[model samples]
Target: MTRAIALHQVSKAYGRAPRAVDNLSLSIAPGEFVVLLGPSGCGKSTVLRMIAGLEEVTEGELLLDGEPANHMPPSERGMAMVFQNFALYPSMTNRANIGFPLKLENPRQDHSERVESTARMLGIESVLDRYPAQLSGGERQRVAMGRAISRRPSAFLMDEPLSNLDAKLRNHLRAEIAQLTAELGVTTVYVTHDQAEAMSLGHRVAVMRGGVLQQVSAPREVYALPENVFVAAFIGTPRINLLRAVVHAPLDGRMSIDLGRQRLPLPEPLSAEHQLLRIQQGRDLIVGLRSEAVRIAPPSHARPGEVALSGVVEHVEYQGHEALVHLNTGSQPAVVPELESARPQQAARRRRRAGGGGTGVGVLERLRERATGHVGGPVVSLDEPVSGRQDPHSPDRPGLMAGDLVVRTGPDMRLRRGGQVPLLVDLEHLYVFDQQGRRICPLPRDVPGLDV
Candidate 1:
């Protein structure tokens, strides 16, 4: 029988170290596949461990099948876990390893038939008699999965199960795991830092940062309507182009976003999303555009909902199917510090330095401010050099700076470096985030009463 899992303001901590899993609340329906995605140290694995009864919930509740299960023993949770390291017994044969759990659960009965069936299901039957040290990485992982499958648990908790395999094998096994889980129809919660894996395998993806849940929704919705700057910057390939912009809305003039050297004029009869920008007049904001949101074309070729902007080609990354063109538009890029990982102590030191004699704020409060874009100073140009530091975006060519915006185009479009190109921005796809990093444009249908 499949199981439902729910966490209500659940948190985990070890003494005074900042909460590893903050007040996170999530629900996973029976037979649904939900992926907990985040960078290392974001507490995704901690959440999975708590659900598996391997870690204690420091605060709040963990419910299994609508029943309170905070104090349940690991074995009594009715869940099986597949770990990252392919936890297997090196001394025992694969067959014995797969059968060990079943043997413990029922010592008098022979479990050979069930073990063989599980091995065959995972296509690891041929390697059953070999020791784990004698098998390949993929084969060993299959053995680990075989062990989990033999138990027929109601829920499957996987913590980067395929992370140890090669890229090709990981892709192959990813598909296999998806198929296997669907057939079993068991509730599954997977944890991984890879966005590609999360987008592909999960029925819904839950993004986490600094031990707090960022956003959770279907893959497409998460990609198309990211709730904040971090989500917008995290889920896409080549990364979204995030530029520092100032909204200029005059009583009788066109509303536009000023991007240092260029301005994006909002077309007349402003869209509801753009209308919301009226409240942001003269305010600094972050503008996001996915590479696909802009195309390399002249102003005359602009389609409906398109605006014009020009850029100088700074770099080109040619992939097989398409090319990513980086352009220097003299626009500033917003930096979301420590987007890949969280280092608390280093962050604390940086905070102390920025606070100019330790502004009495605590770490968690500072993290919340950083997440909301409140603590960081105004947008700074990464292309410029600081007084004592070397320029991070030093020009490859003398006097020519690197690009701040990346646009995807057909691979056939060959363009030379330093060439000026006209681009069309689809206003409908434009994203705007306030100084607090909250999405302001493309406002929700039922707008919240909170002030921006």
Candidate 2:
């Protein structure tokens, strides 16, 4: 059985420190596989916990199948949660671990047949008799999953279930999870910081940050057209290249974008949506390009709706099928401050909890401390538009400039370090965001269930 899920203006706060999840609204169709993806401590897990009734909804409504479900306990909600840490009992055998919940739910009924069926479904029949301590990480996870499915809940909620495993095992288990959920046809909400996992497995991916839903869309839509700088930066491999640029209004009946040392001429007669660039002329903006957006080519090789930019190769990372070419394109990087700050916040939280908990300071005070390492310090670009604003604390420039951007290219190309290369930019694929990190270029219409 599957049920639709909805969060209307949901917010979660610890004490009165603003919201961990701020006015987030989402709707998941029945049997949908949705991934809650973001860096650590971005409130993805908190949202999952709320759905499972493990956490209270401080504000807003949680609807399960169009019924208010906020007050429903975990067991009554018919939702099974697979935790990050394998929460199997140390003393229980794999069979006992898988059947424990059903056994406890109704002691009179024999759970052995159901337990055996689930173990067989997970391909863990060989390990069913072994104790959890005797099984490997992957085997233990299978048992944990078996337990979740044994009860056959209406929904499956996974909170970074593969984070503890090695890469090989993570990949293996990820595929298993995807296949198992689809086979069960259960409404599945999975949480992970691994973009690769989300892209490959989720029917729709919800990108979150600072407790806010950034973008929720099909994986291809999320990647090809990110809703903001944060999504663009977080979703792609080698990260999307973000650089400050000045939009040049139409001159000689054609427009151009000035990327400091390089300029790209727009095709004659800009599309109506792209004509918005005229208003942005002379305005500072951020340009986003995926590794695949730019290729090693000259103007002659430029396709229609493409521009040429020259970059000096600083380094090359040879992947099996492709190479990540780090190039100095003379564009100031538009770093996503949120991703940069997540690690520090996580580290600080771990340390502070170890020290002891207390009522926290206001949001402004917290952001200020995180921004400047001092309380009551003036906040920087975080509160306002970063568009066109130069970094006030830029490090002194050395005599030489290395690649501040990485471009994906085919691995067969022989490119040496310090070599100059011309890259063709797909004008249609470029993304432009304002100083506030919101996507402005391509002029995306409202995506369904995507919060502004």
Candidate 3:
């Protein structure tokens, strides 16, 4: 039978430095598959290691099947782990490697039957005699998984086991792994930076950033209703289009979003949710529009939930299946920093708050203070609240002055680079985040199978 795992406010750290895995708390139901997903150094691996008892928990508790397992050793956790680098025995043949754990437990017992069964299950029966060095990367990965499955562990912890493989092989193995875990009816916690892998392989995904849990919910819920700006921007492909916008709410007129040179009038008799935008009037907030949320259309074809706008086509990219059209709208595009830098910044903030000290912390603070403001002049930075009227049309804003809005469209929609094009923004699908990177537009929780 499978086991339920619960991490209650768990945190891990090396020395007294900031927590590697912050006060993270999550529950995985018995036999359910959960993916811990984020960019590199986001503490996904650390969380997995702590669950596996491979790393010590600096604070809080870990419960396995309603029993505290904080002090348990890795071998006693009733779990099997598949590492990213394929931690197979280099000198051993596939057959021996697959049955290594079983043999270690019962030295005299012949585990050939069990080993062969797992080999066949994983479609690796032909490579049983080959050593790790002689096997291909995919073959080696299967052998490693075979070893883990042969033990009949209660839970499986896979840490980006397919990261080293090519795209084709990763896709193949991803399906195989998902099927195998379901068939075995074992609870699983998988870790990966690839959102595709996380969304496709798990029943739910837990997104992490800077060692802190961002959002944990079903894949569709996380994608469709991201809890914050980071989740919204991180989950989508071609990235979600973000812009600095101001809310326009008149006493008697319908509410709208002011984009400097253009405006989107929200649907009238606004639903309770859209009405919440009124309180944000005249305040600069970030607006997010998924490529699919906007489409090329004329005013006559515009529907109730969609608003129209015009822009100059900057470029067109043919992506085989569809085309990506870049437009120059008179607004500032919001830029999200790479997680590589975010990791350090988050750690520094945690240190400063905790009154800790280190060379890394000091250096980070110095860099933050020395960083220049927005564009040509000492104007409001992207990190700061970008009021709509503050230098609206100025070309001085460094990263994105004239908003480079990219819209996903069908291949048949062709246009010249400088041609004018009309587009529609789906009001129902619009996302809003505050200056602090927290979601604001989606005030109510409407996602299914989610209580947070």
Candidate 4:
């Protein structure tokens, strides 16, 4: 039978600040699969541990089948856990490892029958006599899982169990694990730092950052309609592009982002959920543009509100399907368009509050000083945000800027580091953010069937 898991206001801490798993409230239905995903150290594992009773919860409650399980010990929780490291006994043969849990729980069962059934189910019958030392990594992992499943725990909590294997092995095992879970119809909560794994393995993915749950939805929903900037930045590959922008009128219409020298219009309209932190033409606002939103448009055919910039290619990382261009803007170091753009506006606002005025560079330096807690460092001396952009146009465009801009191009585009290329920013894909780093507008609808 399937069993669900719940965590209400669950939190954990190390000292002054929380280490991982903050105020995280989530419910996984019976037989549902959920993957907790984020960058390493973002607390994905902590949440799984808390659910499994492996880690102590600083505050809040954990529930199994609607019963509070926080104070209960791991063994009493009726849950099984799998770890990234394959914890197997070297002395035990495969048969013994798979049957260990069953033997411990019900010592009266005939060992050969239980062991034979599980070994056949896992297709590891031939390996039953082999010790862990004789088995490969994948074989050892299967043994660990087989042991966990022997007693039929109500739910399974996996903490990157496939992480220790090579990529090919991981792929093969992921399929096997999915098939096994489906056959068992067990509720599962998995944690991983890899987006690909989370996307493929889970029915839903819960994204966490710095111990806080950001968004919990189906894998595609989390990717297409991220609730905030952190989710948008953390979930996608070619990481969503964030540029500095300003909000414009036609309040009910699409969000109009003003790049420093150009203006781009969003294809998706903004919702109230978009928290507008700052809105000024010359002031700073973070604008998000996914790599796929950028295009290599001919200068003559460029549409109005489209942003055009010229930069020499600095470096290109080739993925089989696409190539990520790393441009050197010679102004800001490869600042993620979303995270850093808001700093300038916040700085400007602070300066305006303090009655000071200078250039963007000065304001940026002061903000850096305030951030780093150092008083007299050369803030403007920071490396250019991107490399290769030697000459950017200086037109009086709305959203155009001269700092950092990343252009996502097709793999076959074939441009060298020193070659000058003209890039176009699809303003329709822009993401705006407030001062607190929350998204100021709804993200572009990358997939259909989503409301916003």
Candidate 5:
């Protein structure tokens, strides 16, 4: 029997430290696969532990199959966990390790048949009699999975189980795990720092940052409609091009975003998305363009909703199928600190200073308020005055002289470094983020009562 899991405003704190998991609420349906995706120290594993009954929930509720289960013991949760380290008994043979859990659960009954069946399912039957040290890494992990499968648990909690394996092996096992879980039809909560794994394996991906849930959606939606600057920067290959821009929406003139040396003019017939830029007139905002959004073409070849920009090529990385062209567009790149790690204490202090005490609003409501600019949100703009002088260049790219934009193109196009290239940007695919890092353009479909 599959189980449903839900967390309502669940939080975890250690002494005076900032919350490890802060007011996180999510629901997982029976037999659904959900992935908890974040960087290290972001509390994804803490969440998994809480769900498995290994960690205490310091605040709020944890429901198992719609019943409160905060104090339930780990063994009683009917969940199987696959750990990163494989966690096998060194002194025991693979067969003994797989059968150990069954022996403890029912010592009087013989589990040899079940153990053999599980081993066969994982294709590890040949290695059952050998010690863990004698088997390959993949074989050992298969044995561990065999052990978990023998239990027939209601839910599966996997904590970076493929992190220790080689790239090829990890990919192979990732497919196997997906197939195996689908065959079993068990509710699964997987934790991973790798975005590739999260996008590939999850039916729904929940992105977390500094213990706070950022965005949760299907993989395609998460990629296409990121809710904030962080989500836009974190999920894509080659990363999205984020440029500091100023919206100029003069009443008598065309609306445009001004980069350092170029201006992207919005087409004469302002789109509903572009019309909203009037609210941001003369204000600093971040503009996002995925690699696919821009093409290496001239202004005359511009398609409808396309704008023109020019850049000097700085570097070219030729992958087999395509090439990533890094160009100097004379545009400043917005720096998001600690993109791969968590800083809960600083975030917590910011919240307190901003009077971030619970407003009793749900997550969707809060997101809508930020996106619509109807309510104040966290301001993260380059124009904001600060106490200390900051560098003009991004720390991630030094000595490139504003090589801040990257565009993907066909591998067959041979371009020389320092060559000036004309580009066409599809305005229909443009993204705009306010000073608060909230996406403003392409308004969320669910937000209502907004004047176009």
Candidate 6:
């Protein structure tokens, strides 16, 4: 396939104000499936509508197959679009719905044969006799897609076409759409705010925010190496964690970051061309780390580049295999130390006999000393003594203090409400960003950090 579509200095505005699509320029390859991803009112649908000629361009040109298509009408654009609300006529049968476009366009073609062929391809042949009102949500959606594909347009444009389906059906159709688009070998542009759909279906993703394209790249590339802060925070499930931090120094290929009060290093480095951003040493910057980049663990011996956080378990959200635990930290705490705080708090309670075991500062002293040695002050350790007793003067005793440490752990990991847990972070996977919110380090898979 060749370049199927191009937009040059495309600008669209509703009134005498800032443009909705600001001077956008993009080239879409033939047979490549691209998805415009963004939240509602972010101009994703506007871009698709303009390409389909549903909206008139205000200040630029749109080309289809190397020919300017700005003056073409919707019907003449050589593209088919499916909408969120499947706009099928309730009185019309599925066959008629799929065939109507062809019938309207061609007075000579046999509509029945074309409709049936397309119905079979979408696995909706059995529903051809049923009206839109008689079919299930997924079935109706399929009919809409079938109708669009039946036209055999040069390109397919879809705008959140599966938003009305149930969760299971939505996932099923997500895969089905990917398969169908690939099999049809037609250039396609899909618009959706759903990150899962974009990751699952698009050959490449174009992320937009406030009418500006944030990034345009393969789904995995956009997920792994986002172009900026907006893409980094918006593209993943549970989203990537953004923490305010500062650059310490560059070591080997990685860069150390001070997480406000604490210091930890990231596994990657800034692109050579953007290395100057890293010069703002100790200046406020934002660091991004994906959920998968950090793991929750019980306090244990950790090597260099390993950071731990300690906090009490505040809430636990069970998600079958793993649980998301919100830790009580005074700061926007890290996750690992929360787990460590759990065990030690429990252990110290058990060691105390009567008189509340007055003054348990020994443990606190040890931890505080440990914190001083670490970049950040010593983190609290979880795990109370095996015995169930309370130790006075120990920070873990009563009136639990809020400290930073949060973790998402596995189901089998024993933790209780009001209990402390040490959160062991795999600092090797830490990610750093510059003041502009651009990543300054490589991830672990592409580069190793301090041998974990």
**What lDDT score is found at residue 152 in candidate 2?**
93
Which segments of candidate 2 are over 4 A away from where they belong? 250-253, 341-400, 445-452
Lowest summed lDDT over 10 consecutive residues: which window, candidate 3? 372-381
Q: Which tens-of-lDDT digit does each residue in 1-452 have in candidate 3?
A: 79999999998888855567888999999999999998887789999999999898999999999999999998888899999999998889999999999999899998999999999999999999989999899999999999999999999999999999999999999999989998999999999999999999989999987788889988889988888777888898878888888999999887889876789888878978778888998887889899898888887898878889887776788999899888777767766654324675667577675663666866676556445211111112265433543342345633323336889999988798656788888888899887766788776576755554
lDDT of each: 0.86, 0.83, 0.84, 0.70, 0.86, 0.72
Candidate 3 clash pair list: none
Give the per-residue lDDT of model 1 (tens digit) for 142-200: 99999999999999999999898999999999999999999999999999989989998
Per-residue lDDT of model 2, residues 1-452, tens digit only:
89899999998999956467888999999999999999887799999999999899999999999999989888889989898899999888888899999988999999899999998999999988889889899999888999999999999999999999999999999999989998999999999999999999999999987788888999988987788787888988888888888888856656888877778788877787678878888987888888888889988988888888888777889889888999887677765655665775677667665554543544544555565432112111333332443322234533335566788878899997766788899988788887667788877665455442
- Which regions of candidate 4 are displaced past 4 Å? 15-19, 247-256, 261-283, 299-310, 328-406, 443-447, 450-452
Please give the clash total of every predicted structure, in order: 1, 2, 0, 29, 0, 54
**Over 4 Å off in model 5, which ranges?**
340-402, 446-452
lDDT of 4 by residue, 1-452 (tens): 66878889988887865346668899999999999987777788888888788888899988888998888898888888887887887788888888888788888877778677777788888999989998899988888888888778889989899999999999999998888898899999888888888988898998876667778888878876677667777778867765555556465555555654555544443434333422443445566677677676666767754666556566777888788887643232224322345676676568675664686766776776455422111112223333333344423423323435466678898786555677776544556665445665664444676533
Choose 1 or 3, whichever is better by TM-score.
Answer: 1
Query: How do the residues 138-203 of candidate 5 rate in per-residue lDDT, one tens digit apiece?
Result: 999998888888999999999999999999999999999999999999999999999999998999
Residue 162 of model 6 has an lDDT of: 84
Could you tell me which 10 consecutive residues in candidate 5 have the lowest summed lDDT?
A: 372-381
lDDT of 2: 0.83
lDDT of 3 at 27: 96
Please, what are the lDDT tens digits per residue for candidate 6 over residues 1-452?
32399999898998964568887888899999999998776688999999999999998899988899998898767789999999999989989999998888887878888888898888999989989999999999999999988988889999999889999999999999999988889999999989999988888899877677768877877877776666777787665666666666654455656654445644344445235546767676666666565555654665554566555676777889887666653334222232133676456446653334446765665555455333222122222223433332257565544423335568877778777665556654555555555565543233223122
Instruction: Give the top-scoring candidate (TM-score).
Output: 1
